[model samples]
Target: MNEHILLVNPWIYDFTAYDLWMKPLGLLYLASHLKNSGYKVTLLDCMDRHYPFMPLPDHPGPKRLKSVGCGSYYREKIPKPAQFLSIPRYWSRFGIPWDEVKKQLKEIEPPGWVFITGTMTYWYPGQVAFLNLVRQLWGKTQVIIGGWYPTLCSEHAHQWGFDRIIEGIDPLLVIKQLSSDFKELSTITGYKEFFSVKPAFDLYKKLDYTVVLTSIGCPFRCTYCASGRYFSEFWRRPWEQVLDEITYDYENYRIQDLAFYDDALLYRAEESFLPLLKALQKERLPLRFHLPNSIHARYVTREIAELMRECNFETLRISLEFSDVDSQKNTGNKVDNFIFEKAIQSFIQAGYAPEELEVYLLFGLPGLKAKDYELSIEYVTDLGLKPRLSLFSPLPGTPDFEKVIMHQIKDDPLFQNKIAYLYLSEQNELYEALQRKISKYTFFH
Candidate 1:
């Protein structure tokens, strides 16, 4: 008999988290590969907003989901972790209740192995919690954990007791490692052999949106980013495969919202994104697309913007880390005034509403003054786009980690919590002053 495998996308424990077209693309890809190789795959998405067992909370209705399918997550309040006791905000687990998760696990038969995926480095507590529950229910069933958190903070993950941990996006290597260790568990399936298989979206109880990756890794190496560390090499899949995945989701699954999780989607657009967009236009499927992971501003030319609009791009976000050109160059020449202005104008001319486009402004970098972020926010707002403040989480592998350590911010465990002003010194009043300025500016409302 073929092996039964369980794949889980763990919850996010944070001060604030939204669905924002998020999905475990990597884990689902593995599930698809395993299923195609004759394994019975079961997916447990803890972040499923439409989970049927939970009672609906008294909250606002769903946000304006575009015709293509991107929307929000159902949220509930939970106690903040002990480390964040100093922070005066309610930190919640952004997913289903613990009881519901346990109940679902109880219903499943003993599997050969369980695969778990992680996200933000600071959100490892969620992964730990999920693993603990799995241990409780399955009693020594081998669990494998991988993704951004494990790949970046492998040392920390070892303490969490996962039987095996794989890093990076090399699915073939991971399968080999799993096969060698758990030969009795299942038959080995190489990545090339499973290339044609689609992700097991059918295992999901509710399909809000589907995530697709046309490429992996990024060409540029930014000091503050972990993209290079996670992917290590840039590789683009065939355009036809991308189109087929989109079409399959639209036609067969009735999935309208598709999010591209590529770190570099727009780079070399003539060869990469353009062909895919043209193919999509030719098909004229009534579907909407999103780039939740910010795209490269340097490549967003007017032609690309028009093509994106023609291909039904519903939501897009561009990374505008700093308004100061010198600061931006110091971090990485990821954006320049020329590129920024052109990208903004191209999207505007391409018929995207100002509100539909957002510019992510990184807040709380070491040595950055409160006035600097204030100016950055104002600059993005002046560009006729929403300024979304992405609080900087100091990952272990990023250049910022040494800076953070030198500053002794990590000395206090509370500093590891991303939501807190980690870069600010305990005696520094800059954080409170910046918070006041942000509140006074009031643009997102």
Candidate 2:
């Protein structure tokens, strides 16, 4: 029997969305597992900006490509959800058209099961739309939904029309569940073969860039972050396996850019990162790495910084979540001013330009004042480092979520959108002022 499974990366229905070399990595990993289990797998990326089937008018052209693999998405302004009607900005469905999605589904043979991956809780509208479409086409086919959204808001995910919902980040948990349900478990000869299975990146039509997760979960328990909640365990993968994955993509696909999705890239660097960097340097590949997730400032030792420079670390971001002592203590004390200073100095001494080293300053906390953000920006600018503001989104299962009033959320996941929901007057004023101030000091290096 030909047991085929359809994997879907749903669209982003929001006020704004961007492709920071984003991919449904979990779904791709699942695809590889299914393929190994003797089931045919197909991926339908609804948010594929490069999909040629649905082309936009040449008059406007597609949103201009920015940087090597990061750029804007094809956005179509849609009516805002009833709850977000008061918000001024236009709501958009950021992805290919609905007709194109249906067309792609029709091209493939009907599968026995449709596996859909969910991202942010606020983006549930996209998942709902995807599930509705899947039902229309394959009435009796099983629909299994999983990922961050279902894991964080399992109760809420039930309303999305999924036949079954799986939570947590364990790939083995998923495999075991499927095997028990289907009664056709693939024979696992040994642990070596299991860990050797790579993500099915070949499923994509064209690969612009890929994401890597060398380490799972995070060591620090930040109040605002749900990293610990999602994984609940901190573990690093084998460096040899990581190296093989990177080289495979580089040699086979000619991929130049790789985005690291690790929550703690620099945690215990001597054990994981140090060896990985040394190996990459030995290979002398012309590939550039991007750390989209900020690293621990304290972990940025002089030696690590020097090694990163040698390996062509194109984008380096360190987390300086807050400046004040109270705020720093409240949210995990990942980096203090003293530690941050040393890390910045190390990068600069290692020949990294100011623009190349961006420090992330968090904003939009419940009790945080605008002055806190202003002082932090001033400190980062004074030290000649670029400031990248990461607005806070109150995710369920985070420490900060308990501090706020859940009644205000009203069970609407849309309230989880930081841009649309966290619109405090003071934060808004500070954000705008900082944007204007930083615009004058813009330098590319």
Candidate 3:
């Protein structure tokens, strides 16, 4: 098919991958804006779980038990890059294979422009492979890359020879940047004009779940987080318009599960978030909401917790990164023990069982010890909630990035791998042992 623009969500190459209601909301939103602007846009999402030819007879895996848009991608084992060869975990390409991708691409005529989304910094190898293929098929096309990877590692992304590298989270910048090349966005001033329009999710033949952004940027400046770098200040989308988008997806698309990809969904409970929740509760919809992004523990008030339960917020992951006093204070003092326990109690009182909740406790942070992880895990499990052990990856622009930059992997984005960062070079076997021990301990409890 011919189109004015093409949006591609590249495959993910990692030690492991899972689909937890994943979709390229950024590209989809751009598709909506471009289409409304009188351009035909098509999406080539390699990670799409609902592909027509997926789940082949005796497939590698039969789309591993999708539960409300959460499941596994059709992954095949691919060779790991040389840098990651030290890490003994099996590397896989987590998406549709290239032959199927070729079949899809063969149908489409070369477009006027191609906008590709970049995710994790380490996942660029997947983009690299896909980029090579796109270049070979449609040489010299305008292929602009954007999203977290290009934003965080622009210098590295520039090496790949993209026509343009769009940085930052301002959706206005999308049209603004494209205008520089194609001479179209001079009439557009800000993102407000498109704020009311829903993302082009209707472009999909099937959408199991949808993701929404109620706010841009974050209010807190956590040292390990890059939110402040992505957006200089916190800005809330007009809650009414946001509510309209959510309900439109619910009613029109027949979508029942919605995920909020906001950096801070509850910065100030009295303002946008609370009102949005109240409006949603009033709708009496059976939609299940999820906050996979860590909700600030500081903002969880009794009323907020109660409203969350009322609105059917299914997945509640708290951002209680550190377990101790000083470390907790280091995390922008977002949540202290009293506040953390209070939030849990508030949710419990609001009809949530502790195990139904998940608490994120960071492991392998600079000063943390294995005992610290053990205590942190015990702390969450003791509260009757599950503990999510997140390995620390030093994202560029975060304060911690400097500490890791001194190492050799600084030249390679693969060094920033979240799961295998603890197992780099000479330290591999040691941390590998530690990972095994931690997994064993976790399974034990």
TM-score of each: 0.89, 0.93, 0.92
- Residue 383 Cα positional deviation in candidate 1, in Å, after optimal superposition: 3.5
- For 1-445, candidate 1 gives per-residue lDDT tens digits of 5878889888888776766777777677778766666788888888877778755544543557533454445556787766567766777777888778888888889887888887776677778888888888888688988776676666767877898888665655566666665453244454334356688787876786888887766888888887766544667777888898888888777877788888899887787689899888889998878887899989888888988999888778899888998889888799987789889899889988877887888876777777788788788777766777776767666787667643434443235556664423342255556656555555445
The alpha-carbon deviation from the true structure for residue 283 of candidate 3, after best TM-score superposition, in angstroms, is: 0.9
Where does model 3 exceed 4 Å of error? 1-3, 56-65, 425-445
Model 2: per-residue Cα lDDT over 164-235, one tens digit each: 888765555555565655555445332344456788999887888888878877888889998865554667
Cα TM-score of candidate 3: 0.92
- Ten contiguous residues minimizing lDDT sum, candidate 3: 56-65
Candidate 1 regions exceeding 4 Å error are 65-78, 182-195, 405-415, 421-445
Identify the superior model by lDDT, candidate 1 or candidate 2: 2
Candidate 3 lDDT over residue span 26-45, tens digit each: 78877776776677788888
Q: Compare the candidates by lDDT and give the number of the best one.
A: 2
Better of 1 and 3 by TM-score: 3
